[model samples]
Target: MSIHLENFKNNLKLRLDDNPQLHGFQTFKKTLERDYFSEVSIRICFKEAAKTENLVIEMDCNLDLLEMLYHLQKGTWGGNLSEEEDLPPNSSFARALDQLQELNEISIDVEEFSLFLNDCSIIVKKIYSNSIKDQLGSILSTIAEHYVYFTKGLSETPFEIYVPVFEDTIPENDYTLSKIREADNQTKDYFGFWGLYFDSEDDAVIYDLSNKSIVSGDLYLLNH
Candidate 1:
């Protein structure tokens, strides 16, 4: 999904503004566990070296984002981004991301952590390189490495996003879930969970969060 830094900031501000006491926006990185996964790319006109620099800037940018998130939630800035950062527009952590804007670099202004940031303002969070690159690794692990697209700010926090329907959430008679114990059933009737293609080998490996599902085909819910 395309990300708008201003949109995120505005939404977050609105949410935080409405619920002033709700200081922290806790978003998990468990999206990888869902069945539906998509690729993310930037319209970067830079070369390989630029890519490297972009990566570095991304690194610092995330650090600052996280530090600020933590501070915002904790009600203190402390000294999180005090060190030299590798994010774009090299500068001290304190001066990196302008609160006026959601992101400082915004790589192609592309975003992967969009779902997590939806309607939630700044909370305790961190952005990382490995996490960004590898956040979808688990999803890719189930499929071909070359088939997926990882985005610039994929991993915004060390925590994982919550699966829409966790294994623990699967209550008996839930309709979608039949086999409770080691429940492994695959058939044309599997229509409850987020329908995901695990590998190129076949369409049999429907994605379930670790074992749960992402409430597949619920794009309609996004409206709310």
Candidate 2:
């Protein structure tokens, strides 16, 4: 009596429908469109693996768009941070950027991401716990709750589908670009840009922003 793919979809739909507030999202089909230097739409979709049978959540976001948007919103495009005029603390854009910065400070684990979505294709076989529905519901709720803010964050590098990775994981370098192209080939598995290797069961991990490599530890620098 294991969970099936259909069970995951049904349960997820039920979870979203149960919450009346999320009706505006239209079951995650709607994309977030914005124009800073150019028009960009944050599109989300669901796909299941044909062979490995993994649930694949796909998001279309570009790092350049996010960086430009941040600069335009914050007025930090050509000048240093100190020279830039800051927005009010309560501004939605400012607040969203703050949250995004916080997310970047601590690397998020693939097993634990605080974001939501409307539709998801989850491979039942990959889920290790019995509370699969509950897990999906929580994740979706988080996504829907901060949909706009999360969209802003997604416009950044590494382009988090759920979990956040390093900026170097982007296709700027040959190594990373090759990896990205290869990932397109393996559509069945979750292709995390930066693989996590925990040295212990500690809550903290050292994140090096310079080289974009993570070292598990408690006291780590927020920036290089």
- The best candidate in terms of lDDT: 2
**Model 1 weakest 10-residue run by lDDT:** 20-29
lDDT of 2: 0.27
**How much is the lDDT of residue 47 in candidate 2?**
30
Best by TM-score: 2
Which ten residues in a row are the worst by lDDT in model 2?
A: 108-117
What would the per-residue lDDT of candidate 1 be over residues 95-201, giving only the tens digit for each residue? 22122123233432111222222222211111233232222222222212211221112322222121111122344656554432231332211222222222222
TM-score of every model versus the real structure: 0.20, 0.21
lDDT of each: 0.24, 0.27
What's the lDDT for candidate 1?
Answer: 0.24
Off by over 4 Å in 2: 1-22, 27-31, 35-59, 65-69, 72-224
